[model samples]
Target: MAVNLAHFALNADDIPTSRAFYEKVFGWSFVPWGPPGFYHIRTGAEDAPVQGALQQRRELIAGRRTIAPECTFTVEDVEATARAVVAAGGRILMDRFTISGVGHLIFFEDPAGNAIGAMQSDADAE
Candidate 1:
């Protein structure tokens, strides 16, 4: 049996800001896909569940919007990943948090100022 990660999403406070950030930093391109909160961004064919949209958030985002927006990435170690993020000049929003007892996670911003996250299962050791 084959299993894989596919078709995931990330929320953007403002399409324009997120779009430009991704383009400049990650070289990802965005194209209109569905409705107002929909976009198709160019991404790698790796395990990344793909960014379907950077839609406008209705929650507080970087003092911009007010949407509980988040982007999830498969990581080996949440703490190590977070540490690497800080070493690379990325700011960690929260130290480490839990969600529904599923796993541990942390949020951070990209070089272009786009917020993203890294997550690891609860079974993962520190």
Candidate 2:
């Protein structure tokens, strides 16, 4: 199966500042969701709008932090994809985990050291 960019999340130190900037500059809308400091971003695109979120910044893995937007790829099976990632010289940073209403997810770093996520959709993941 071909994996696709399913979502992207922006990590911010200051939610209000980042949210306001996106709202004013990009005309994006934010809806509070999930945890206290997390929000769903609406980009107002006419076509198939890509899923996006803004959340508080934290370590991507242990003491290492990610400064760029975290991108998530949708796949049929996260475990299989994770195996392929490792086979292709990538390193798994996190094991598989459920995201309640979202799906099964795994975090990994590419050979180039870019941290990303792979998700397998399942509304009943909770």
Candidate 3:
């Protein structure tokens, strides 16, 4: 099972404000990507720089705000991982969905209620 933390995203109520804060504090670069109000984050690291994003906030589970940064792990199989989450006492917050060029992805909350994501990368996905 591939469990590498592949990506991290900050869910912000104010994208512009959050973008500026991160930029001023960390010197990270933000590039508009994907949909409107979403930006890809780039940390100027010489070593292993992880991918990140800044996007408009949304409820992970009905009426519950995602207050913490959610991270996604690279998995070999999204569906299998989702099943494992349920069996391990976690709840699925979002079902599998295709992200076009990205892959099949799913969102779930851990036993402690931390929102997480898992993705089976497939560049050819559509």
Candidate 4:
């Protein structure tokens, strides 16, 4: 039941523009994701696993756009972790939600206001 850093996501006002910037500046490459506005970012070789994604700002919940470079952590149980977050004086910014074929996730703010996310794998949830 250990929690681990899972993924990082960047919020962008314009996905194509952001992707181009990262590609030129950092040598990153991107592939379109499920929807029109999302793209998976590849920082290295094509065979290397994608480390993060560039998501359109409008796709995220309100107030979340202000926090770019959001870090998501994998947890044993997102619901339990969310409860613990509240008990520990943190605030839940987004309630538990599921991503089809992926997993359940929740967003929360640390006491100091840093935004973070927790995810529970779909396999584990089942």
Candidate 5:
């Protein structure tokens, strides 16, 4: 038998802010899943990709803020993707580097200053 995980939620200090950061960083979409303050974020993949997330926490109260970098993102192609993220207004937090036998990786800050990562599989690094 096989099991699949649908979505993951992070405690965001500010949902809208987190949403905007993620959307800009990963090109995802967010939708409501509950009351006014509760929401779901969907990460996009594979050209017209779809994903989902549920969120709730002590952040974002219509002007007040509490969100921070809350996740990790992996990509098969890191070089081009890093360039694209920058072109779209995001900043790479670190230069790409090898991680022992893991492969090449880089960390970046989203438009909202949330830390995120991008990686290239070992097979693709060669």
Candidate 6:
């Protein structure tokens, strides 16, 4: 049941502009993800290097301003962990869903209202 910090995502009203800014400022490269309007960010080449993503603000939460960057943690079992989240008093904002080749993901808010993501990779599920 070892959970590891997996990725981070930044919500942007304008995907291209925000992507350009990060590319220029941080020199990060991006690859198109499975879903349209989502891009996977590459920050470094280290083993288990922390990765990130740029997503449309509207895609994140409806009628809410973008807050802090969202952090995604990798879990061994998304469904079990999602249940654990509710048992621990956290609220699930998004239910488990597959990302094609990526994996399964769920979004939830902690007791303090901070948004977080959980991912269970396809490889790990097998």
Q: Residue 99 in model 1: shift from native, Å?
A: 1.4
lDDT against the true structure, each candidate: 0.67, 0.92, 0.91, 0.81, 0.62, 0.85
Residue 2 accuracy (lDDT) in model 2: 74
Ranking by lDDT: 2, 3, 6, 4, 1, 5
Show how many residue pairs clash in every candidate, following the order shown: 8, 0, 0, 0, 3, 0
Candidate 3 off by > 4 Å: 44-47
For candidate 2, write residues 1-126 as lDDT tens digits.
Answer: 777999999999999999999999989999999899999998746697879999999887667777899999999999999999999999999899999988999999898889999999999998
lDDT of 4 by residue, 9-126 (tens): 8888877788889999988888898787888887755585646888877424454455568889999889899999999999898899888777999998898778888988795442
For model 1, the superposed segments whose C-alpha errors exceed 4 Å read 1-61, 66-70, 123-126
TM-score of each: 0.49, 0.93, 0.93, 0.82, 0.42, 0.84
Model 5 over residues 34-98: C-alpha lDDT tens digits?
46666666656558544355465643233434354234456766787689879989888777877
Give per-residue lDDT, candidate 4, residue 64: 43
Q: Give the C-alpha miss distance for residue 11 in model 1, angstroms.
A: 5.0
Query: Candidate 3 lDDT, tens digit per residue, 1-126?
Result: 548988999999999999999999998999999899999999747597888999999898888988889899999999999999999999999999999999999999898878899999999999
Could you tell me the C-alpha RMSD of candidate 2 in Å?
A: 1.3
Which scores greater on lDDT, model 1 or model 3?
3
Name the lDDT of candidate 3. 0.91
Better of 1 and 5 by lDDT: 1
**Candidate 1 overall lDDT versus native:** 0.67
The segments of candidate 5 whose C-alpha lies over 4 angstroms from its true place after superposition are 1-70, 123-126
Arrange candidates by TM-score, descending.
3, 2, 6, 4, 1, 5
Estimate the lDDT of model 4: 0.81
List candidate 4 segments past 4 Å from native: 44-50, 58-64, 123-126
- Cα-based lDDT at residue 43, candidate 3: 78
